[model samples]
Target: MTPAFSLAGISKRYPDFSLRDVSLTLPEGQVMGLVGVNGAG
Candidate 1:
């Protein structure tokens, strides 16, 4: 079955912080959470 939520080829860039080639998939009937602690600039 296809995913309920899909993310691909995600990236973020900054002089102090960066995130590259990030990917995630939340399948159907599943719960997911993204947490960032002190991960802010």
Candidate 2:
């Protein structure tokens, strides 16, 4: 079987925040949430 969605070595950088070396996976019939603070971006 294979993942429905995958993120390998993903990264996002900003002046105030940075996300690095991120990895994620999602199979069938699943839910995901992407959360942040009110002032987060």
Q: TM-score of each candidate?
A: 0.70, 0.71
The residue-by-residue lDDT of candidate 1 on 1-41, one tens digit each, is 89999889899999999989989998899996666687552
- Can you list the residue pairs that collide in candidate 1? none
Residue 40: error of model 1 in Å? 11
The local lDDT score (0 to 100) that residue 27 gets in candidate 1 is 85
lDDT of 1 at 29: 98
Compared with the true structure, what per-residue lDDT tens digits does model 2 show for residues 1-41? 58888889999999998999999999877888776687453
By TM-score, how accurate is candidate 2?
0.71
lDDT of 2 at 12: 97
